[model samples]
Target: MTFSLVGHCAETGQLGIAICSSSIAVGARCPWLQPGVGAVSTQNITLPALGPQVLEHMACGLSPTQALDSALTRNGYSQFRQLAAIDYRGRTAHFSGSETLGCHHTLPGELCVGAGNLLAGASVIEALVRTFETSGGQLADRLLAGMQAAVAAGGEAGPVHSAALVVVGELTWPIIDLRVDWADEDPVGKLAQLWAAYRPQMQDYIVRALDPTQAPSYGVPGDE
Candidate 1:
């Protein structure tokens, strides 16, 4: 069973996504990104390798639909694929293959989409989308809210095992990539909590990565 969130942060100019599954370690295999190009979520019958290629297609100037089409077309088992893409400009597109694991569905909005397969109920994707729009915050907040939205709507057919979120810039490895490789239950909530606790540190890490030679001359006490 699978549940995933793909969205872009207009404020930060970052594109990101979070995914969780009944199967273990979906994050490691499902989410991928290119700093200034875009982000991709390759789920359902997951193909971890295709994740970056989707971004590559887009970076080559493919539209969301074209990029998705090309990526799926290349796969022999395209019928079972599920994908979400957000381009550098934040134009979004999503598709749930007709042959997705089981009873799969998708909900797409202006700049985001929620997709699932083998879920407990049909309304799950819609609930994810609705909550995402209602959350009203930064892109990461909305993305987390959307993941919570899916969980509140019943999530996977079984307990969740893994979750991940990745926000990237054009050259950044991952701006805010959080992975809960496995959790006992309520993986999404756990993920959000982790994000809150690590957000400041994550910010510092990115700043340091961008300009490692420059040290913080002063701040709060020993932090300097």
Candidate 2:
């Protein structure tokens, strides 16, 4: 019931994940990323702990594939889990277990991995990877584009109600983290609108957190 992609931007050394699902609050469970470490998406039956475990393994110097393998081996029901990881160096790996629900596919690319279960078909994942590879702009933008492309190519077997986009740069906190917990309409598009509004002020928000005295004003009415 979920489709997700984990990606790295070689130019900026940023890592990110974009995901959508028919399930409620998919973002809070599926996507994980640590600055300078890696990005992981654990879906299918959705083992939330495995996402962080994979990140920790990568932080301990394991490659994406090695980390995924280690995580899978430790799980008793590995057959129900779908996993994907992309390391700091942009090496990518993915696994869709044999028992994943409905149709599923994982497309591992040079700097990204796209995976999905209970999807429209292989074309969903295909469009995700292809769009991510060809689209330009920030890493977050490309990730969103990939998500949009998946929907265009026929997204989840059912309508997707929740979506998320997360990107981390060189900070302790994510550079971009947006989610639509549940929406009757297009959650991905709602996320895109949030990104558009957030893009110009993202740096300002960080600056405020790091040094408020030097931060810009509210840019609102009557503040002076």
Candidate 3:
């Protein structure tokens, strides 16, 4: 009951994933990213540890295909999982095991890969990759657009309750990580709204973390 896309932005050297699921808190479990390494999404039965494991493999110089193969090989339940990864070089890979849920598919594109299980149809994944590859602007914007397009085309087999968008740049920490853990309706839309609100302050937050004295004021109470 999950659909996800992992992408790399060549212009800015950013990597990220956008995901939606019928389950609660999909963000807390699925997406994994290392600033200069890559992005990975582990869903469909969701072995959360596999996200990190795959990233570790990528960090050690494996291609997305090899990293996924190495990681899944070590797992006892590989056949129950669905995964996608994109490396810093924009190379992509994906896998949908034999036991994936209804209407699963994977679409690999220039700088992104979309994969899902228990989806409405293969069109959902196609929409994800197509929109991501064609859209313009920041990595976060393309990711959000891809997700919205997928929902517009046809989402999961049922209503999705959780959505997450994560983007990592040069820092060890993510530049953008937004989630709507559980929403009765339109979780992806809610996630997009969060990204909109966070966008203007995203770089400021990074500066604050690195050097607070040079950072802008909070504009609240005592800071004024």
TM-score of each: 0.90, 0.97, 0.98
lDDT of 1 at 107: 78
- Candidate 3 wrongly placed segments (more than 4 Å): none
**Stretch of 10 with least lDDT, candidate 3:** 215-224
Q: Which stretch of 10 consecutive residues in model 2 shows the poorest summed lDDT?
A: 215-224
How much is the lDDT of residue 118 in candidate 2?
A: 93
Q: Candidate 3: give its CA RMSD in angstroms.
A: 0.8
Q: Assess each prediction's global lDDT (C-alpha) against the native.
A: 0.80, 0.93, 0.94
Residue 91 C-alpha lDDT in model 2: 95
Cα distance off (Å), candidate 1, residue 82? 1.1
Point out the higher-scoring one by TM-score: 1 or 3.
Answer: 3
- 1-224, model 2: which lDDT tens digit per residue? 89998999999999999999999999899999999999999999988999999999999999989999999898769899999899889999899888999999999876999999999899999999999999999999999999999999999899889999999999999989999999997999999999999999999999999999988999899856
lDDT for each residue of candidate 1 in 15-97, tens digit (9 for 90 to 100): 88888888777878988888778878888888776777788889999987798888888876787788887887878878887
Clash pairs, model 1 backbone: 35-169, 35-170, 36-170
